[model samples]
Target: MTQTVDLNADMGEGFGPWPMGEDAALLETITSANIACGAHAGDWDVMAGTMALATERGVGIGAHPGFPDLQGFGRRRMQMPHDSLRNLVAYQVGAARGMAASVGGTVRHVKLHGALANMASEDAAMAQACYEGALSVDPDVIIMVLAATAQQEAAQALGCRWAAEIFADRAYNDDATLVDRRLPGAVIHDPEEAGARMVEMVQAGAIITASGARIPTPIDTICLHGDTAEAVGIARATRAALEAAGIALGVFPGRR
Candidate 1:
């Protein structure tokens, strides 16, 4: 049987006069784009432009909501009440939806970004709060969750449409969490290596940890970071490799 999976990337992470990532090039490679909401790394104009490009490329659009810490690029953790977290997610998703709609696109999924995503992956309650916020606005929006984590647990508990994601440029810990970025070789920069690893994981239908432990989980999507030229290369390479391996690349069915 031919295997199919969605290739996704976090994009639109730029402010005025300062652009981040190769979004235009990535739109050509990825099947889905997790666009940054205004709070963490984007503004209305950026969102609209990115969404328009994705629409033109026939890519699936997803909202990437994170903490309000723009300075830290939403990579720094900040404590917030559960209610506040829910509202924050809701507001960002709504803003993304509006921007996408203005560009004749619609948000098909929601993925928490940066520290918020890392935190939620460890705390089922927190993941539930964020997913609930997205659901409140669009009940059919697919929630992208880290495979085999609390985020997945929360989605299953809610019985909402969801998809599992794995990282293409990141090394994983034995427990399935990402390796600390501070560690050497944690963030992979080699395009061929990244592409090969992605093919291996997708074929295994599991997350192969750094120690070679295969953690079985649904591999619905492969996340490629587009924060740099090398990252974009990795994305393209991964897509090519998947196709060469006879794995079909397309938008995930999600839960709907």
Candidate 2:
């Protein structure tokens, strides 16, 4: 079992006057923040506010770049040329890096969001394009990849600094892909249940699938969604559970 791990959550996903997620409350429990860029959700003000809060809390800040699908919250799949995908990621990541720097913080890592992430998790070429784009902007920035997926494969091929992440509130299929959100029992809502699952996965050093399959992989971080009150509770509980299990929670040491 890994002795240390990082907890991260997606935040700053609001646009204009609209708000999404309990970012402030989530920040109290997570060690890293993946702030949304304008392409999917969030504007300059939202990004700045999120970055400031993360800086104040002494948490690692990361860019969460996704497709330009604000209406779908970037969850709708879209096909595009690999070069365009690269440019898209680069633009969002650069914007996030600047926002963080303006607030006396820096983007320590980059994580793909929504459909882009889902697509990349299965397409090594796409994942590589996205990571290369991020690296082009800042070679030192860590790439946070979904553990045991093509996202991890791309990062390994690039030989760049990276972190492996697993979902704390989502069910995984036998193939390590997330179960469709519309499916029954796809998203775990109970705090205790989420917490216990996280502890079990960390201890087992693998992702326990919905059908009880365990796929071993490096678990550098656990991802929690902050889009709802229940998610915030789960985040807190998961942090406590890890602590109780003697696992230190902190910013991940980007791939050794």
Candidate 3:
């Protein structure tokens, strides 16, 4: 049997007065938290609160750096220069890092969010730029990335620590990439379905797509989207089911 995997959740997307998810409950179920910086849908106050909650719950802290597209939730792709991209990434990461530090915590990792992450997955140049940006911020921070993608390869090549991420609430294509969001059956909304998917990935090291094709992957960490419908329920169920399958969640053991 393979070693147990960690389970992570994207959180802290709330921006002043607008809240999202049951942060406390999600923290209890997840071993790691990818707290959104102000770029997407978080502010300084929200970041501080999220970091504090996660720290108290003993969850590992990760900076979730996204494009500065709060209106579109950082999902809309935009043309950005390498230097601009680098600064944006660094800015968001530092924002989260500062908040975590204030709460007697430290940022353990960095994960690019939304369109930025998807672009980095397929674009070698983008991956290189993002990795360099993350290194500039904190050279030792583990970079969470989609397994087997260009981003993951580039991070490894640069001697940057990384975690191979798999999604519990999303379906994958034949090539192990997430299915298009607009497509039917792209997202696993049912809590039971989401939980089963996580268990299958952990135990079998494979993810089944909507077309019934199995894609092999190393699920070092499983991600549950904190903004999905019934996200709290899904996260709790997925974590519980994974544990029942003998998979215990924790930080991925990577270089400091």
Clashing pairs in 1: none
**Per-residue CA lDDT of candidate 1, range 1-256, in tens?**
8999999999999988899988998998999999999888988889999999999999999999999988999989889999999999999999999999999999999999989999999899999999999999999999999998999999999999999999999999877888878899889999999999999999998999988999999999999987857977999899999999999998998862
Give the higher-TM-score candidate: 2 or 3: 2
* lDDT: worst 10-residue window of model 2: 225-234
Task: Give the Å shift of residue 42 in candidate 2.
Answer: 0.6
lDDT of all predictions: 0.93, 0.94, 0.85
- Give the winner by lDDT: 1 or 3: 1
TM-scores of the candidates are 0.98, 0.98, 0.95
1-256, model 2: which lDDT tens digit per residue? Answer: 5499999999999889999999999999999999999998999999999999999999999999999998998999999999999999999999999999999999999999989999999999999999999999999999999999999999999999999999989999998989988899999999999999999999999999999999999899999997867988899899999999999998998984
Instruction: List ranges where model 1 is wrong by over 4 Å.
Output: none
Task: Please provide, for model 3 over 72-186, each residue's C-alpha lDDT reduced to its tens digit, 9 standing for 90 to 100.
Answer: 9999998899988888898888888888999999999999999998888888688878878878989889999887677777787887888889888888877667887889888
